[model samples]
Each structure stands twice: as structure tokens, then as C-alpha cells.
Target: MEPLNIQANQLILLRLPSQNIKVVKVEPGSIISLGKFGSFRADDIIGDPFGFTYEIDSGMKLSLVDNTIEFDEDDQMGAEQAMTGHKITATGMQQLTSEEIEALKSQGVSGAEIIAKVMEGHAAFEHKTEYSKEKYLKRKKQKFLQQFTPYAIGSTELIDIYLDKDPTRIYNLSPETLALALNMGNIRPGGNYLVVDETPGVLVAAILERIGGEGTITLVHENEHPNLDCLKYLVLSEEERERMIKTINWLELFHPEESEPVRTKTAEELEDLKPSHRRQYYRAKQREENHKEILKRADTCGFDALMVMTLLDLPTLIPQLLRFVGGSRPIVLYSEFKEVLVETTLALQKENRVLAPTIMETRVRKYQTLPGRIHPLMTSRGYGGYLLSALRVHPNRAVNAVGKIS
Candidate 1:
């Protein structure tokens, strides 16, 4: 596993103080903005090791620093027990005026120094307990810190990036739901998979990561063009997509005979064309050959599993898609609404070709359970939705072999 470095003109995830992630391209000699968090020059981070926190200095230059903050628990906490931050804010909170803070910023003071200055103004600083002080310090850092971390875009961060940016874009498909679909589908490296992605490309991206570019993912889409636009953020190279991902629209998958590209000239006649003309001619011919191979793969040996994450009519779509899957293969479907997956399971149950069908919904929460200080994590929230699972099989009549004892 090679470490991915920060490169110019490539997308990287920028995590700011607000806990929001911005997918930014590091263009050389250009300014990268983080909205209210201010902007920084791209050159400051280019060619550096990725996933390291880069603190903004004087609003332009950046310095590498560890993002972790230590919260040393006091051994004698009983002697200093005090009320939380909310119980006492009468006159012990902030004393410095907003104008003074702006003045400090104009002087080009560092964020940590500015935070120290603000803490000096808090009259209740020494009276609070260790936990309360830690909470106050964290809030001050989030409010005044000009630090940001640039992370390499990969499968591990795509879920957090999308959920923070726009959950609705991916149909609210949480990390747990994505994992369930992959495991239930029996996805693995070097295995062939059939996918119908309507969560845009999040589901497809997850499959690509699990397969690790070892096998094929035949993506069946509903539009004239495949909507795997999210692959760019997961796997950066176009060549990787061309090699590992094969796409066929619904029309092409259902009726390959009618969707074939027509040839304008024979190979021998094409040879007489100029070099520039020959380049385009050969590219189209090769693409056509690849399309034929993909169709053949679907009609012959078949795929190992079939996975679906779509907003279309699954009750009608999934049954027809199951034909491309081999016998004993698993089929997993994801949907935010339980009723939709329940409807899909009911429709699959009626088709005797499927085995015991099941539908399930799940959720998760992050917690920090320390003695005398048990609570959910700061950013704790519930996630995940619903899934419908079943297995594909071939119908056969029972028979016994006739034999005579010797």
C-alpha cells in the first residue's frame, strides 16, 4: 500500500473547524477557499504528505501540526468537581469585545496565541472542572482556529465526505447500510458483480474498493449514459475506470442485439485513412469490441452476485436483473424507506426462483463511555436505513437415480 501524496490539480478532502469536508482541487498558483474559514495558497500543500493537518499561518502560509488535542483526566477529580459550562455563564464567559478580537486578527497573531489571550479574559477559567475546561478550550479552538487538514480521497473517507456535504444526494445511505449491502452481496476481490446504482455512485464506489481493482463490476444503469460520476472521487484515474468498471444501460443489457454500434467502414477500407482519422476509427472499434465482450459475459458464465441501490421501481426491475446472476448467488437491495425494500422482498418472494427473502433496518451511534463521564461522542448521531436480502437460484424438479443391487 503506497501512501498517496498531495498532488496538484487533484481532488482532496479538506476538513475545516466546523467539521465540514470540502472536496477541493489543488490547482498550482491558485487560491483554495474554505468559505468562512478563509483561503490559502495551493502551493503551500502541494507535494507534501497527505492526511496531515496544515495550520493556516497569517491566513496564507501553512505549518504542519498534529490535529490531536490532549485531555488529561485529573486523578483527584473529586476535589475539583464543578458544574458544567451551561450552568454558569453569567459574567465568567467572554470579556474581550468583538472589536478587540478583530484587532488581534489584523495584527496577524497565531490562532493558539489568540485562544490563550481569550482564555485570559475568562474570569471563570480556574473555577471549572477539568472536563469543563476541556470543553471550553475545544469550543474556542473551533471558533478561532485557522487550521485545516488535507486528506487523500479514497473509499474510507467518501462516506463522511458525502454525508457532511449532502446526505440527500446519496439517498441517505449510511456507512452501516453500505457495509450491509456489500457483505450481504458477498462482494470480494476478483469476483464479478452486477450493480444497479441509483444512490448515484456511492454504492458502486464501495464495491470498487472491496474488489480492489481485481475483478469486474458490470454496472447496469437506467439512463442513456451511466451515472457513475462518483468513481472519479473514489478511484482517480480514467484508465482504472476503463479497466475495472464496465457499464451498460438498461436498454443495452435487456436487448443487446438492438443496441450495437453500427460500423461506417470495413477494416481494410479504414486503413486508407490518414493517421488522425485512423486514431478515431481504431478507438471506436476497440470500444465496440469491449461492449461485445461485456454483453457476452452477462449472457454466459454470469456474475457472482447482484447488488442494487436504486430509487426506481425495484419490484419490477430486480426480478429481470436476476437472470444475469449465477445460481446460488446472493442479491442485496438498499433503500432508505423500509416500505420500499419490504415491497421488493414481497415481490421477490412470489418468484419461486429466490430463496428465503428477508428485510432489515439498522442504525448506529458513537459513544465515549468512561467511568463517571459516560456520554455520546461530540458528533454522535444515528445513521443507516434498510436492506432487503435474498439468494438467486435455478428451479429444478426432484429426481432419483434408479439402481439395482448386484
Candidate 2:
């Protein structure tokens, strides 16, 4: 595999000091104006590697910084200093007027120099405790720093961005639950998967990343056209996109029909046809062939795994989807509400088509991990969502097992 580089026309994630992220297209010779922070020519960072931090200033130059750090430990120390103290006086602490701050910004001073000047003018700088002092400096840096990190956007980073922007867009799915579903389904390269993704396309993109160009994802969507908007951000070549992803409607998958026969032509006949007619003839033939293959796969019932992330009623959805998955293959379902999955699990249990249906949820608690002030953060997202997973199996009546009826 080639090492992924920041290429022109590809989407890259820019993470700001304020912990806000922006998805930007890397177009060469274009100016990327980050508003107040600063602006830089896209050419400066076009060929650079992903996951590097760059500081932009009025000089229109880019300075690279190595950002590899242990995030948990660093986050804890930073949080402890910021939140483990009494609220400081919002007014009268800093003597620099708004005009002075704007002048400094316009002058294109380095982030450190600006922060130092702000601290020097702060009337209560000497009175603050050591931890409080660190907190103030950090806050000032976040506000005035003209710095942004360009990270290689992957599933987890994309999820964080969506969660912050609009939870409803991705059904409030979390990285933890997404990981669980992938593991439970045993998703890997070269496997064929049946997916119903109403999370728009995050789930489909994640699967594509794991499977690469080898595996196939037959995505089932409710409407006539599939909603895979998230795939627009992926930096995939045309060949990879065509080789890995395929889409089908729910009605087509469930009630497939033989496609109309397309007219055929000999090599001589095709050469003699008009250019436009030849192109149309080839397209029709390809569509008919693809439809036949999809219908065959649907009828064969041998998908490697079945993964679904949708808001539709699961109890009614799962049973219908399970029929397309082969025996002993994993079936994983994700929902924002546990109640939704619980109902599906009960139905699967009653039908005896799945083995040991289980509902599981994973939550991550962040903390301020200083030696003396370590504790959970005061505010965090309350839910990370839930997963209902089970394996499709064949029920044998020839020999009685402990849980089987004779």
C-alpha cells in the first residue's frame, strides 16, 4: 500500500486549538482563510504528510510542529489545571484593551509572543496559583494561536466531527460502538458484507477502510437512491471506489426481478454504430449484467456478515435481513436507544435463528489526571449508543443438543 499523502482535491481535517474541526479541500494555489486565526496558501501544505500541525500567520508562511503526544496523560493534566480551581474574575484580570489585542493580531506576532504579552498585562497574574496560572496561559493560547493540525481523516475522526456538528446526522453513533460492531462482525479484507446503513454513509465508509479494495459491501437503502453522502470526503481513487462499494434498494434486494434483455451487437456491428449509440448500448449491457449478479447474490444467502445501523424498527428489520446472511455468520445491529435493540434481541431469541443475542454498550469517561486533582470531567456526552450482536446458525433436529428441542 502507498503511504497516504495530502493530495490536492482531497479532503483533510483541520483541527484548531479550540478543539473545533473543519473539513477542507486541499486545492493547490488557493488561499485557505481560517478567518481570525490566519490564512495561508494551500500550496504551502499541499505535499506535506498528513497528521502534522501547521501554524499560519499574516506572513503567509507555514511552520510545522511535531504533535505526537500521549493524549490521555496530556489531556488529564491540561483539564486538571483548567477546571480544578475557582472561577477567576472575568474582568480586570487582563489590562490589554480589545484594540491592543487586535493590533497585536494584525501585526502577525507569534502565538507564544502574543500570549506572553497578554500575561504581562494581566493584573492578577502574580496572584494566581501555579495551576491557575497554567490554566490562564492555556486558555489564552487557544484563543490567540493561529495554529491548525491536519489529520488524515478516518472513521473515528469523522465520527467526532459529526458528533460535534450534528448528532442526528449520524444517529449519535460513537467510535466505541462502531469498533464493537466491526469486531463482532469480523469485518476484514476480501469478505462480502450485507449492510443497511441509515447513518447516511459513515458505517459504509468504515467498512470500506477495513476491507480496502478486496471486499465487497452490498449496501441496502430504503429509498430508490442510496444516501452515501459521507463517501464524498474519502480520498479514494475512481478504481477503488468502483471495485469496493455497491448499492441496492431494499425493494430490489427483497423482490428482485430479471432485468430486460439488452440488445447485443457483433464487433463489426458495434464499430459501425454511431458513437453515442455505442456508448448507450454498452451502458445498458453493463447495467443488466450487474443487476443479474446482485439478484443472484441476494438469492444465494451466503453473505459473510450482516451489519445494520438505522433508525427503522429493528424487530421488523433484523429478521428480514438475517435471511440473507449465511449460517454461523455474525449479525450486528447498532441503535442510539437500547430499547430499540432490546426488542430485536427478544425477537431473535424467540425465533431461535440466532445464538446468544446480547445487547452491549461502551462508554468512555474522560478525566483530569493530575496527581492531586484527578477526577471525571464535569461535563461529557451522556450516551455512546448500544450494540446488539449475535451469530446466525442452523438449527438441527437430527441430533438433540442441550438447548435444542427434539
Candidate 3:
């Protein structure tokens, strides 16, 4: 087969077909050995001046346009090999399977690496099963996995980085994106914002990382719950965790009031105490100092917050949440799906405390193929996620008489 070239921002996904388990992501510039069958690096097949194609293990070329390779011999051999570990007779290119493709997309694997791996060894063989004859056509009909195709954003760019995390992964929004959102309307550096369905402290960490103002961020969850339970298993390095870890969980902050007045030096008399008495006075003050840190966790609730309520409950909860911040602040709501968001939005629109409420949706696709004609393709995964944004305006509030809209 013709030697392949690989490029950046792409990946290869491998799987255990029987178990539907994603085995690994093919790293760029690394050699993957299918054993005596052959070995190749994902980078070997990307960015070639020529388009994608396959050739025999002897280096005899075949173009996708020619389409002359027979699947019959290859298919039979692939089945035999899958069962008996027989080596492939020749090198040929094909696409990754649907499950493998989707797994790569979820991890934000790029397209370049995908194509190279396909050239290296796309199994053109049929998976053997008791229902093989009946399921054969059905399985063959599945071409590229549809969901793995990348979703379009507002515009295309020459280069973009993709990060794939698990659905429940703690996510910190990009500072640039947040900065743009904050500057959208009357949002300011220290103003409080509300989050729904966010991982514990992720959004807060993003905010704190950006505009390091003294203003506090309040966290809200249903049943007076803080979201720290979700953080117990995050796969972050210790260095990253140190900065991300803040005791935002409301349960961790609750303190009893009876512990107060642990100091007994009488206020007036305490002020006049000599340095020696003051030293002894502060010695007793250690307990109060410790308790202060504990109570501040809850009582010092930085930004006012509310619960995760149903669509019906939003009408009541949104207004109450607005009252806490009043009209001067901004409210951010994130929904996992759009229908509920539309319902929530309609309710908020009627309240008249909302100004410039917006619905924004973002999508990302990874592992794009650049140079191949019949590309070693994997469709991108995360297709239709959304974001809804709006400004909260109070009834009878003064209008900003003049400003250019973005």
C-alpha cells in the first residue's frame, strides 16, 4: 500500500466489536501494530498532496475512483482472521465502525488521525454471529455513523481545538467565551449569575479565573443541595484540582450559633487590655476563628441562588431568584435540552423582569479528514446541544437610553 501521511487534530478509534467497547484512541505520530498483518502510524496518511486511496501490501496503487478492489476475498479472509488470527494478505483502506467513530468524537478526537487509521486497517470483514445472514444487510446499510459528523458553528475556521469529556465531566467554560457573554449587555465583572445543570463549582471556577473581583458567586441546587457530590470522582490532576476545589457545597458550610461568644473579655475591657492580656485573649479566640471559616462557608453565601425546579416551577422560582439579585444583575440558565428551555423562556418573557433573553446553541465536531478522496471518515458525535441566554429587567426599570447592540 502507498505510504500514508497524517496531520494534526485528528485521531483513530478502535473497538472490540463483540463487546461494543471502545479500546483506545490512536495517537498521532505513533505506530499501531496490527502485527504481521501490518503496522502504521495515524500520521502517515494525512495531508498528502494526493487524495485518499488504498493500495496492495506490495505497493501497487488503487484509486477510490477506480473502485476495483473486490470485497469478497477480503471479507471472507477478515472473518477468518477475526476468528483465527490469520494475517491480512494485503494492505487496504476502509472506514472505522460506527461505535468506534462515536467514541472518538465523544473524546473530541480530530479527523486527520481518523483517516490514517482507516488506511492502516479498516476492517472490511463481516462480524460473525448466529444471525449473520439476517442481519448482514442491515449491518451493511450502516455507512458512516451519522452522529459522528461534526456540527457547524456560526462560522468555520482554519483551525479549531476540540475537548471531549464525559457527559458528567466537570466543565469549566472558556474564559474568552465567558468574557464575550458577560460583555453582551449590562453584565459586569462582579455581578452574580445563576447556573442550572452545571457540574459543581466548574462555572464558579471559570468565573473566578477570569475577572478576579471581590464579588462572590452563589451556587443553587434543588432541596438546598450544593453540587459537590459530583466532584468526588473528577479525573483532574492534583495541580488542577487544587485551584478548582473550593468548599462551595452548602452542606460543608453549615454552623451552629451557640458556639459564638466563646470569647469572654467584655468588649470595653477587652479593648483596654495590655499586650500580655491581648495575647491570652487571642489564645481563646482560636476556636472562634476556626468556627468563622466554617460558618462563612454557608452564611457568606456570596451570590443569592435558587433550586433546580421543573418548567412549571420556573415561573415562581425565576421571579424569586430575580428578586434576590434585583434588576441590576444578570441571570444565566443552562438547559440540557431545548423544549424545556423554550417553555422556561416563554414564561420569563411574560414576567417583564427580563431584558434581551437569548437562546444560543453550540456544536462541535472532531477528527476531520482533509486530503483523501474517499476519506477514511468517522462522523462527529455531539450534534445538537444548545444554550439559552437573556437579561433580567425589572418592571418600571429605567431603560438604557442609548447603546450599540452586538
Clashing pairs in 2: none
Measured over all alpha carbons after superposition, the RMSD of each candidate to the real structure, in angstroms, is 5.6, 4.8, 15.0
Q: Which 10-residue window in model 1 sums to the lowest lDDT?
A: 67-76
Off by over 4 Å in 1: 1-3, 70-94, 103-113, 116-120, 124-139, 260-264, 272-288, 368-374, 377-383, 399-406
Give the clash total for candidate 2.
0
Ranking by lDDT: 2, 1, 3
Instruction: State the RMSD for candidate 3.
Output: 15.0
Candidate number with greatest TM-score: 2
lDDT of 3 by residue, 1-406 (tens): 1113323433322221121212122456665543322344445444543333332131222222232221122233444344553333325555667677657645544333333344345354333432442244224322222111111111010011122334333222332333444444233355443434345444444443333443334444444444544222222244443322323332322324433465567878888999898877885575355435434542344233221312234544565555544443455554445666677788787667667667666553333221111222244434343345665544643433343233
The better-scoring model by lDDT among 1 and 2 is 2
Which candidate leads the pack in lDDT? Answer: 2
TM-score for predicted model 3 compared with the true structure: 0.39
Instruction: Judging by TM-score, tell me the better candidate of 1 and 3.
Output: 1
Report how far residue 213 has shifted in candidate 3, in Å.
6.2
Q: After superposition, how far is residue 257 of candidate 1 from its true place, in Å?
A: 3.5
By summed lDDT, which 10 consecutive residues of candidate 3 come out lowest?
150-159
lDDT of 3 at 99: 79
Model 3, which residues run further than 4 Å from truth? 1-198, 212-215, 221-225, 229-313, 326-328, 372-378, 382-384, 397-406
